[model samples]
Every structure is written in structure tokens, then in C-alpha cells.
Target: MQYDFDKIILRNGTNAIKWDGLDKTFGAADILPMWIADMDFEAPQPVIDAVVNRAQHGIYGYTEKPESFYSSISNWMKKRHGWQIDNKWIEVSAGVVPAISLSILSYSEPGDKILLQSPVYYPFFSAIESNNRVMVNNQLIYENHQYKIDFNDLESKLKTGVKVIILCNPHNPVGRVWSREELEKIGELCIRYNVIIVSDEIHSDLIFGKHTHIPIASISEELAERTVTCMAPSKTFNIAGLYTSAVIISDDTLRGEFKNTMNRLNAEAKNLFGIIALEAAYTYGEEWLEQALPYLEGNLDFLVDYFITKIPNIKVSKPQGTYLAWLDCKELGMNQKDLVDFFIHKA
Candidate 1:
């Protein structure tokens, strides 16, 4: 069945932050709100059906992650990425950001150094620092309109007694799906330095064209022992509001510590609707994704071509995965503040 990708749905007054809360968020209600990562499109029909069915039952009580939840996650991982994971490895969390913060709290002390690739998802900075951990930057190298890991800098930073390194697998803001070779180099360094890796693989399912997302833990047994992978149906199925995500930890010790943290913080309880939506999404959302991906690719193509013809100065760094397009606006001769104002106020 073909999904309607061209249909425009009115999200205003739906409590959607991207549409309804625009005035509060961006100081203008009329401005098109494209800041949040949430998709404008509705989630899969099956997901909607499941959520609505659950709501119709009337009692919204505390929910638990059932055996089927783990099965859905494990099966989806294997089917989509060729990564086979056991049910025990999956731990349900409220969201990816919360999982990251919990992992930071669980694995590292307040003064310990936590590493991140610079220009990553902004929340990562807060996740590390807000926990009183020092944030270290192993910046990515941008060359030829593509982003590459500065392995030398990464290794050097790791050597300085870093306790944890947060990795954005298909990096955000700059979307290069890290190749196996790149992941291997990173894995080797983490192993050598005894650094725990918290990999945010939230965008793992949104690959474009021939690009493949290799779960860093799926690389090797050694890597899996130290890696905590954060994944969710939220990004894939446009269900971010559900706040349901999974943190896959193969290591028993790490899993125990992370779960302990969750329990201590009273955050282990799963959202009822989120659980229903997640299971439905994982079980039946693939057809929707299959259609959505090509539509997104077409959108990307249009943006690239449009930039070439109309906005040549704002070069587009075409992504290998995810729907985000990174625009390089250095050629526009505007400083950061002016450029932001240009897009926010003047454009």
C-alpha cells in the first residue's frame, strides 16, 4: 500500500511544539517552525491504531515492558541491521536523551571526563556537563563538504583519562554515517583507554541510498562489552512525544549499573501508550518506512538542486542517512548571529 507523502496535515493547535508552540519557542507564531527534529508527517497507521485502541480501553495505568517488547526490538535490530541481540540486553527508557544522561550518571563520576565529537547534538553537551562531568571535544574534520573523524585527536583525548565517550553513530547536524572502518578505529581506542561508549543510534533506521548503519556494538564482542546503544522507534516512526526508547547493553555489569540508576531515579516505569506504540511500530511500521525513505530522498534531492540554482552560497552537505540537510553558510559573508537572524527574522 502506498502512503501519502505529499499530503499536508495541519498540526497547529495540536499542541505540537513545532507548530503550535512556535510563538513561545521562536518568538513568532507566523514563522515556519522547522527547528525540532520531529517529523511533520503522521506516524504509521498501525501505530495509530494500536495507540488509539489502548486509549479506548479507558484506564491509563502504569505499564511494563513486556516480553514482546524486547522481542520486537531484537527482531527489528536483526531484520533491519543484521544485528542479533538477546532480550536481556534491552532496557526500556523514557527517551534517548534521558538514557544518555542515565548512562552518564551510572558509568562515570562527576569529575571524570566525557568525550564527544564537537558540533554533535547539543543535548550531549548538557548530558555530560549537567551531571558535573567534564566535556572533552574530539572534533570532526570537515573536508570536501563531508565530515570525518579526527582519529588522532580522538585517541589523544581518550588517553587523557576519559571515562566515557558519547558517539552519534549517524552523526547529527552533520550527517555522515560512520563507516565500519571509522567505528573500528573508535572501538580500538575506547578499548585501549578503558572508556565506555554510549552510542546514540536513534537515527539508525533512516539510511539513504547505499549507505548502511553499522551498530558499533555489532562490530565485535569486545566492543559490545563496553558499548551502550540508545535506539528508539521515535525517530523512525515520528513518535518522539511517546518518549519510549531502548538502551541495549550486552555487558551484564553495565546493564546492572544503568538499570540501578534508572530505579534509583524512579524512571524505570514505562509509559503505557508508548509501549503500545513502540511494539506496533516495530512490528508493522516497516512498510511505512520503506515508502517514507524514498520520499525523504526525493526531498533531499529537491533541496540540493534548489540550493544549487537559487541559494548557491549556502552549500548543502548532502547526508548519507537521516532527513536532515546541513547547510554551510560561510560564503554568505554573514556572522553567526546575523546568519541566524537572516533565517529566523529576515528570511
Candidate 2:
């Protein structure tokens, strides 16, 4: 079935964080919100159907994760990325950011150093700092309108006894889908320095054109052992409100420790609707995603053309993956606040 992406449903009164917070967030009530990561489109019918079917049952209670839940995720990983993951390696979490915070608690001590590439998903900074861990910014070098990792800087930071690195695979904001060679370089550094890598592959399914997302753990058995790959159908299927995600730890020992941490914190349970939505998205949302990517790419193209033709001073880094277009408004001779104000006023 053809999905209708052009129909702009009014989200203003729905209490959407993206829509409702425009005034509070950017200090303007009238700004068009292209800021949040969630799409303006509706979720696929299968996902909606699954959640509705679960609601029809009417008995919402504490739930145990079913074997099918694990199987759906495992199968999807294999089918989508050609990566083999056993059901035993899966850990359920409410979301990727929560899983990362728990990983900080599980693997690193307070005052231990964690590495992040910026300007990344802002939560990466929050996850480390809020957990009482030190954050090391291995900031990406922006050149030629694309962001590249500064390996020399990363090596220097890793040498300082960093304990963990939060990697954004198909990174947010800057939108660089890490190449195998790039991931191998990162893997090499982490392996050598004995740093635990938390590879958040939440945007793995949203890539465009020849760009492909390589799971950092999939590089090698050694790397997989040191990696905790956080993934979700939420971003892929536009179901962030579902709050379901998978934390894949291939190393049995690491998985055990992570599970122990979850158990200690009592955060292992999955919501009933979350479980059904996740299963449906992984099992049947592929075709919808296949269609959605091109439309999003079209949106990216439109933004590019619009900027070049109408707003030439505004520079947008063409996203390699993910729906977010990182617009460099610095050249417009305005401070960050001024740029935000400009967008708000214009929108």
C-alpha cells in the first residue's frame, strides 16, 4: 500500500514535544519545528495494528519478554544488516539513552572518563555527566561540509585512560554513517586502549544511497566482546513513544554484567505495547521503511535546493544517513542564539 507522506497532520494540539515546546524551547510560538528527530509522518499500519491488537486484550500488567520478541530483533538484524546475532545476546531497555546511562553505571566507576564525538546527539553528553562520569569530547573535524573523526585527537584522549566511548553509528546531527574502515580504526583504538564501546546503531535503518551502516561490534569477535550495540525499531518505524530498544552484547560476560546492573536497578521489564510495536515493526515494517527512506531523501534534496535557491547563506551538510540535516548557519554572521531566532522568525 502507498503511504501518504504529503498529508501534514496537525500536531499542534497533540502535546508533541517537537510541536508543543517550540515556544518554550526556541522562545517563539510560531517557529516551524524541524528540530526534533521524529518524522512528521505517521507510523506504518502494521505497527499501529499490533499496538491496537494488544490494547484489545485489556489486561495490562507487568510483562515478561517473549521469545518471539528476541527472534524478531535477531531476524531483523540479520536481514537488514547481514549481521548474525543470537537471541541470548539481547537485552531489553526502555530506550538507547537509558541503556547508555546504565552501561556507564555497569562498566565504569564514578569519575571514570567516557568519550563522545560532538556536536552529537546532545544526550550523549548528558548520559555521561549525569552519571558522575567525566566526558571527553573527541570532536569531529568539519571540513568540506562533512564531519570526519579526528583519530589523532581520539588516540590522545584514549591514552588518558578513558574507560568507555559512546559511538553514534550513522551519527546524529552531523550524520556520518561510519565506514568499515573508519569503524575499524575506532575499533583498533578501543581494543588497544581496552575501552568499552557503546555503539548506538539506532539510525542504522535510515541510510540513503551508497552509504551503509556497519555495526562497530560486527567488525570482529574481539570488538564485539568490548561493544554494547544499542538498537531500536522506534527510529526506523517512527514509534519513539513506544520506548522499546534492544541492547546487544555479544560477549557473555559483558552481557551478564549488564544484566546484573539492570536487575539491580529493576529496569528489565518491557511494556506490553512496546513489545507488540517492536515485533510488528521488525517483522513487517521493512517495505514501509523502504518507501520512507526515499521520501526523506527527497526532503533532504528539497532542503538543499531551497537553501541554494532561496537561502544561499544557510549551509546544510548533506546527510549521509538519518533524517536530520545539520545546517551550518554560522556563515550567516550570527551567533547560535541569533541563528535560532532567525529560523524561528522566518518559520
Candidate 3:
């Protein structure tokens, strides 16, 4: 079946966080709403069909996650990323953000330092601060039009007794698919410091070109023991509203801690529809994802060409993964506030 990604559907009345709050988020309703991470396209027919089929049943009761859901997730991981994830290691959460919050609570104590690479997904900051933990930034070194981890800085931060490192693998905004060598270096640093790594691989499947996402936990047995890998079909299948995400903890001790935290907070159960949508997406949404990546790449290319040829003052660092385009408007000779105003007016 042919996918129509270019067909922009009307989302104004759907209570979409992207479209509904345009004026509130950007200070104007006229701006093109590209700032949010979710896509503009509808999810695959298979996903929609599954949700609709479940809705038809009309039995909204407390539900248990089936064995098929776990199997689907494991199969998808092995097939797409060459990662062998056992069913026993998986923990369900409402979303990755919640999982991050829970990880902070489970693994670290108050006043402990949690390391993050910036300028990252803004929520990483909140996840740290909201839990009464100190946020330490090992800010990425931006050089040669790409973002690279500063290992020396990371080591320094680790030495200061940071308990955890939250990584945005195939990172957001300033997109850079972390290489194997980079992942290894990070793994080494975390191991050396005895710090836990929370690898958010939410965008792992959204990669473009020859770029590949490496799960930090899958780096090695020792790294796996220290890493908590968070993944979901939400971003890939455009199903964020479903609130289904998987947290893979390879180590039994860490997994037990995470599970205990979730159980204590009563956050372990999956949403009924979330399970249905997740299973369908992972099992049948592969071809849809495969097709979507090329269209997104085209969109990135179009945006780059448009910015270069037409909007010469604005520079977009071409993304390695994810649909988000980090636009550099410093050349517009305007301050950050002015640039935002200009885009709001122009968009």
C-alpha cells in the first residue's frame, strides 16, 4: 500500500499539543507548528485499524498486558536493531519521560548528581530537578557542523559523584546519531565511575541514511548491567497519545529496583489500548516506518534547500535522525527574542 506522508491532515480539533497550543507555545497562532517532536502525518492503517477494532469491542475494563505484546517488542528489536532483548528484562511505563523520572527515583537519592548532555530535550532538565537531584551538564562540543560528546568533561562530571547519565541516543534538536565508538566511550566512562546510564532510544527507529542507533545497554555485558534503555513505538508510529513505552534493564538487580519503584508508585500496568496499539505497530508497522524515513529525509532536504536558496540567513544543521530540524537563525542579525518574533510573524 502507498503511504501519503505529504498529505497534511487537519489536526486543529484533536487537542493536539503541536497544533492546539501554537499561539501559547510560539506566542502566535500563525507560526508553522514544527517545533513539537510528533509528526504531522497519520499513523499507519494497521495501527489505526487495531485501535479502531479495539474501540468497537466497547469493553473498557482494567486490562492485563498479553504475552503477545512482549513478544512483539522483542521481535521488533531483534529484527530492526540487531539487539537481543529478553522478555524478562522489559518494564512497561506510561511514557519515556515517566520512566526517566522513575529511574531517578529508583536509582539515585536526593542531592545526588544526574548528568545529561545539552542542549538536549528540555525535559531531561525537569526530570532531574523535579526529583530533587542536581543536574550536571556534560554539554556536547559543537564543532564541524556536528555534536560530539566531550569525554573529558564527562569523566570530570563522573568524578564529582554523579549517580546517573541520561543519554539521548540519536539525540533530539541538534541531531547526531551517536557512533559505536562514542557509545563505547560513554559506556566506559559510566562503568569507570560506577554510574547508571539511562539511554533513551525513543528515536532509534527514526534514523535517516546510513546512520544507525546503538543501544548503550547492548554495548557489552558490563555496560548492559549499568544501562536502562527506554524505547517505544510512539515516535516511530506517531502513537504518542497511547502512552506505551518499554524500559529494558539487562541487569537483574537494576531491573528489580526499577520494577520495585514502579510497583511502589503503582505505575507498572499498561493502558488497554496502549497494549493493542504497541503490539500492532511493532509487529506490522515495519514497512510503514521503512517508507516514512525516506519521506522525512526528503522533507529535511527540502527544508535545507529552501533555507539555503530562499532563506539564506537561516541555517539548518541537517539532521542525522528524527524529523526535528534545528534551525540556526543567528545570521539574521537578530537577538534570540527578535528571531523568534520574526519566525512567528513569518510562519
Candidate 4:
């Protein structure tokens, strides 16, 4: 079955933030908004069917993540990334951001320093500071048209008594999938420093050609204990609105603490549709992903070539994973306001 990557689904009336909310967000309805993270294409038919089946039942009541939910997700992880996860390790959550906040709350204390690689997802900052924790940056080194971790700076910060290191594998904005060596180096540092690692692997499934997504915990049992891994089909299936994700913590103690935090927040129940959609996605969306990936690679290639030939000034980061691209506009040399205006008004 060939999937339609080029088919344009009308989302303008669907309250999609990427489309319908553009007027409210950017103050212009006609800017061809591309700032949001979701794709313009529809989710897989299996996912649609799952949600529709649940919807047709016509009873929206309290829902829970069944054992099958964990089994389905576990199977998907094993098959997709070769990471074996037990059902006990999976904690259902509304989304990755909430899971991060919960992990931050569970593992670290207020005013305690936590580390992040900067120019990351903006919510990471709020997840730390809003919880009254200090945000530390072990900034990534950007040179030769790619990004690399500054391990020395990371170690220096860890030595200063950082409690938790929030990691974004297949990093956002700058989308280089962290190499195994890089992951191990950071893991070793965290272990030595007795710091917890909250790795956000939300975009793990969307990896491009030749790049693999490695679950941090899968590196070793010890590292797994020290890590809180967040993942979801939200990004992969374009189901963010459904708000379901898994926080995989293989360590018994860490899993307990994170679950305790979720219980405290009263977030244990997932919506009926999200539960069905997640199961449907993991069980039957493999074929859809097989088709979608090549289309995504083509889109990325086109963007790269267009920028190089037509714009020549703006540089777009070539992502090894995820559909989102980071545009490097440093060469434009305009102030932030001017840059915003350039895209919103001029470009």
C-alpha cells in the first residue's frame, strides 16, 4: 500500500496550532507558518481507525493504560530500535514535557543545579526553572557545519554538583543524533558525578538514513538505573493533541519515584482515544513509517539544495533524525527583532 506523502489535508479549520492558530500566534494568517513541529500530512490509517473505533463507542470515561499498551510499546521499541524494554519499566504520561517536569521534580530538589545542552527545546528551560531548579548549560560546540558535545564543559558543570542532566537525543533545533561514544562519555560522567540523566528520546523514531536512535538506558544496566527515558508516538504519528507518552525508567527506584510524582500530580489516567491510538500506532503503523521516512529524506534534501542554490546566505542544519530543521541565520547579521521581521514580513 503506497501512502500519500504529497496529499495536502485541510487542517485550517481543525484548530491545529500549526495552521488555524497562526493568526493568533504570529499576528498574520498568511505567513505560511512552518514554526510548529507537527507535519502537514495525516497520521496512519491504523491510528485513525483506532481513534474512530473508540469514538464510535460513544462513552468518554476515565481510562487507564492497559498491560497490552505496555506490551505493544515494548514490542515496537524492540523491533524499531533494538532496545528491549519490560512493561514494568513503562510509565504512561500525557507528553514528553510533562514527563521531564515530573522527572525533574522527582529526582532533583529546588535550587539544585541541573544541566542542559543549550539551543535546545525551549520548554526544557521552563521545566527546570518553573520547578525552582537552577539551569546549567554545557553548551554544544558548533563548527564545520555540525554540532558536537563539549565534554569538558559538561564535566566541569557536573563537578560543580549538578543533580540531573536533561538530555535531548537526536537533539532538537540542531538535529545530530548523539553517537554511542558521545552518549557513553556523558553517561560515564553522570555516573561519576552521581547525577541523574533524564533523556528525552521523543524524536527517536524519526531518524534519517544511516543514523540510529539508541535508548540511553540500553547502553548498560547501571546507566539505565541513572536514566529516565521519555518517548512517544506523538511525533512519529503526528498525534501530539492526543497527549500520550511513555517514561521508561528501568531502575526500580527511579521508576517508583517518577511514578510517585505522577500520582502526586494526579496524572496517571490517559484518555481513551490516546490509549487506543498509541496501541494502534505501535502495532500497525510500521508500514506507514517505512513509506514516510523516504518522503521525509526527500523533503530534507530538497530544502538543503534550495537553500544552497537560491538563498545562499541562510544555512539549514542537516538533520540526521526528526522532521524539523534548524535554520542558521547568524550570517544574516540582523538583530533578533529584525530577524523575526525578515521571516514574518520580508522573507
Candidate 2's residue-wise lDDT over 157-263, tens digit each? Answer: 99999999999989998889999999999999998999999989999999988998888888899999999999998889889988999999999889999999999
Worst 10 residues of 4 by lDDT: 265-274
Q: Write the per-residue lDDT of candidate 3 for residues 1-347, one digit (tens) a residue.
A: 78988797899988998999997787777667877789888898899999999999999899988888999999999998999999989999999999999999999999999999998999999999999999999999978767888888889889999999999988987889999999999888888889999988999998988898888777799999999999999999999998999999989999999999999999874698899999999998988998999889998999889888998877777889888888776677888788777778864
Model 2, runs deviating above 4 Å: none
The segments of candidate 1 whose C-alpha lies over 4 angstroms from its true place after superposition are none
Q: Candidate 2 — which pairs collide?
A: none
lDDT score at residue 339, model 1, on the 0-100 scale: 87
What TM-score fits each model? Answer: 0.98, 0.97, 0.97, 0.98
**Deviation (Å) of 31 in candidate 4:** 0.8
Cα displacement (Å) at residue 136, model 4: 0.3
Model 3, backbone clash pairs (residues 3+ apart or across chains), number? 0
Q: What is the C-alpha RMSD of each candidate to the true structure, in Å?
A: 0.9, 1.2, 1.2, 0.9
**Which candidate model has the greater TM-score, 1 or 3?**
1
**Candidate 2 structure, TM-score to reference:** 0.97
- For candidate 2, what's the RMSD? 1.2
lDDT-best of 1 and 2: 1
lDDT of 1 by residue, 1-347 (tens): 67897889998888988888878976788887778898888899999999999899999987667899899999999999999999999998889999999999999998999999978899999998899999999998989889999998898889999999999988897888999999999999999999999999999999998899999999999999999999999989999999999999999999999999999999873789989999999999999999999899999999999999998988997799878888888898999889878988887
lDDT per residue for candidate 4 within 228-250, as digits (tens), equals: 99999998988889898988988
